[model samples]
Target: MSKHPGPSLAQHPMPWWRSGYLWLIIGLTLAMLAGGVVTVWLASQQPHAPVAAPPSQAEQGGSLEPAMQARNRTSSRNAKALGTGGD
Candidate 1:
């Protein structure tokens, strides 16, 4: 009898298309693609309204500039009165 064993034959693996893992990956990819398509279609159908600026129109128009200066002055005066103002 030969000390060496005969070469063992292993069965061939299943094709990628028949693999469950391959199908899972394909299914997930198709799902994500469908979701993206639906999202794009919904977005395209919506109104394209312009977004308005915030409610602080004074900052943009410079109308609140004087009010802000007056507030700063009042705070400085209060700080000096309370002796919390840095020299």
Candidate 2:
């Protein structure tokens, strides 16, 4: 046999800290990834709020109705003044 001996057993044995910590790092990375996925899912899940409807006729104190009536009256009066139709 050669003069030099083979490597020591302890030198090759896995270090205690590295073994557990490597798994811990893997677990934390997985947890973060899962959390990110859940966050995106939650963000996309919500429905949008509905748009407000326009005010009803009663809310405007009959403003539009009076304007329409005035317009009709003016049209009829103009028609009579022009003598283009019934007196």
Candidate 3:
């Protein structure tokens, strides 16, 4: 065999922290942990207000009549176009 040995047979192997891949993995994990902590803190600081329910048609006093008429007109037009005679 030659006097020179392969890298695997070296007397001292590289340390874990010195590895580029290890550093990359560690950095990504720390960044994700930081992001999660920030998100949780923000969520806790400003909780959403309770939403109010919308009034029903009767409660709103027939405000949707015009919209209903327009919807009926559109339905009849579509039915006529399809030769269904608008029922």
Q: How far is candidate 2 from the true structure (C-alpha RMSD, Å)?
A: 13.9
Worst 10 residues of 3 by lDDT: 2-11
- Tens digits of per-residue lDDT, candidate 3, 1-87, equal 669765683667888778999889999999999999999999899699999999898797778778989999999999999999895
Say what the RMSD of model 1 is: 5.9
* Pairs that collide, model 2: none
What lDDT, from 0 to 1, does candidate 3 have?
Answer: 0.89
Displacement of the residue 3 alpha carbon in candidate 3, Å? 8.0
Each prediction's whole-model lDDT (CA): 0.83, 0.84, 0.89
Best by lDDT: 3
Query: Residue 38: error of model 2 in Å?
Result: 0.6
C-alpha lDDT (0 to 100) for residue 63 of candidate 1: 84
Best of the two (1, 2) by TM-score: 1
Give the range of the ten consecutive residues with the poorest summed lDDT in model 1.
5-14
- Give the C-alpha lDDT of model 1: 0.83
Model 2 scores a TM of: 0.38
Instruction: Give RMSD (Å) of candidate 3 vs. truth.
Output: 3.8
